[model samples]
Target: MAFTVSANFAISADGKISSDPQRPSGWTSSQDHKRLLELRRNADAIIVGRGTLCADNMSLTVPDQTPQPLRCVVSRKGNFNGNEKIFHSHGGDIHLLVTNAISCDFERDSVTLHFANLTDFIETLHRDHGVKHIHCEGGGMLLRALLDYDLLDTLHLTWAAHTLFGGTNAPTISGLDDGIFFSSRHFSLVEMIESGAEGELFLTYQRNDAAK
Candidate 1:
């Protein structure tokens, strides 16, 4: 069976994910953080880019939650120090999807899977691991790959209008650099809520198969 994919991001008014490529998104409100955990509750696994993993120092573990979801990270080269917070946290089994040919040595129980590309890894997750729903908390580049493959089924966005990360190099949901997908993908808004007090808008979109 094919698994469903969803992603969540906190975008700024200027459509930037962060002011700097290495900066963590600490500007978002507590409400936004709460929503992130809420989304994790529905996921069978959480996938993130290595840059996001490191930048946020993410544990990838849902707090006080049972049957913790698998934490997966993707990187071109598996060059991670064993010091990432995910390694020390008590979460579900960790899986590393290395998309390039490289050898990594880390003394940890994490399982490393080598794949030629992101699409292969995503397919293998459903085929081998019984992953029915995968959620992504991204740092842009990984989200771009999902959009490139047209595999993302749902998108949840926290539009924080009070902040602006206004740099040409700042990334949107796609990435830091300028590029276009092979084809335009369309989405239909499923839900929209405005948090006037927080100056944020919560938006949920579902893939529009008929449109694109």
Candidate 2:
């Protein structure tokens, strides 16, 4: 049996997942941030792509008042600063999963680095790290891989009202083949509603076992 995975992210009403490279505000509403932080508090671990880590310089830590979830990054190239905020001593537990060929010496108060096969990474996370629920805060390619591998069991999407960069480089929730499976067979909508924050809509979907 494959371990279960969940993905959560914000998008625009126009289906744009990200804004222009020069600006990223308004892509996620304040209420969306609150809800996402709540999900982070409930999750066992939070997974993100290297690009997110590098681009945002994110510490992956919740506010001081909230309980923090373990941070995990997926990177094949192992291209990240060891002393970044996410890997800092004050940050909560952190883990990095990289390809076997990449090498790095990361030493922090509670940092662990694992080099493993991409196919088995999720299994290892569940078996060895006690990660029962994973919240993937993605960067497109990583989400695509998880969807392609059928590793994601649930999706929580918050659609913001504003539009962003509509060019070829922006990330969207539904990929080329994604809509076909999601619409006809592999997945089913579990919930959808216009949340109270601004004009955001919260959508949730789950996989259909019969289609697997």
Candidate 3:
């Protein structure tokens, strides 16, 4: 069985993913947020990096919905607070994927912490958990790791016209690469969505079957 991995992110026209360290305000437009929620609603499981979870303090739950999809967080250090809104609330199932070096003594039926390599973690999510569709909402580090591993099958990107917070430390959706050669095939444009007053381009790309 083949599992599909799709990445979704909003970046400025200048290709900056986030403007601030604490909050990502103005990076993603209001219309993009609505579309993201709809994508979340359609996904079987939504995956995020630990940095994004801690920075945003997200609960990762859909409001007024029952039997929500599992919330998965990929963390090598497993340093997140258990008392955070995501773990404390009993809305949906929560799964934490951590390296074997991390240890946790927390006990809760609603939450399950698993230790495995990142590649094994992805395989388990697909083969054991019955996850057909995986959506990645990321911090740049995570995106880089996935792309490096060639785990991404598709990408959904929204480019906004606003530009904010640029420096050596700020991260972009596509991280540092030494111009490594990789084959690229043409992908059809899905939609050119405008976010309210400002026009933001929503683009989707699918990997070529022959390339894989």
Best by TM-score: 1
- With candidate 3 superimposed using the best TM-score fit, by how many Å does residue 191's alpha carbon deviate from the native? 3.2
Worst 10 residues of 1 by lDDT: 106-115
Q: Kindly report which residue stretches of model 3 are placed more than 4 angstroms away from their true locations once superposed.
A: 20-22, 25-27, 100-102, 105-107, 175-188, 209-212
Candidate 2 residue pairs in backbone clash: none
lDDT of 2 by residue, 1-212 (tens): 43567888787766766754223433366778787777677677888878766666677777774446778898886777676667663545788888755577654556677788655777777788787888887766578777766677888888776555476656675432334444332668889978673877888888776322
lDDT string for model 3 (25-119, tens) is: 33366778777777777667788888787777777777667667678888886777676677866555788888755577655676788888767
Question: Each prediction's Cα lDDT score?
Answer: 0.86, 0.70, 0.72
Q: Count the clashes in each prediction.
A: 0, 0, 0
TM-score, cand. 2 vs. native? 0.82
Better of 1 and 3 by TM-score: 1
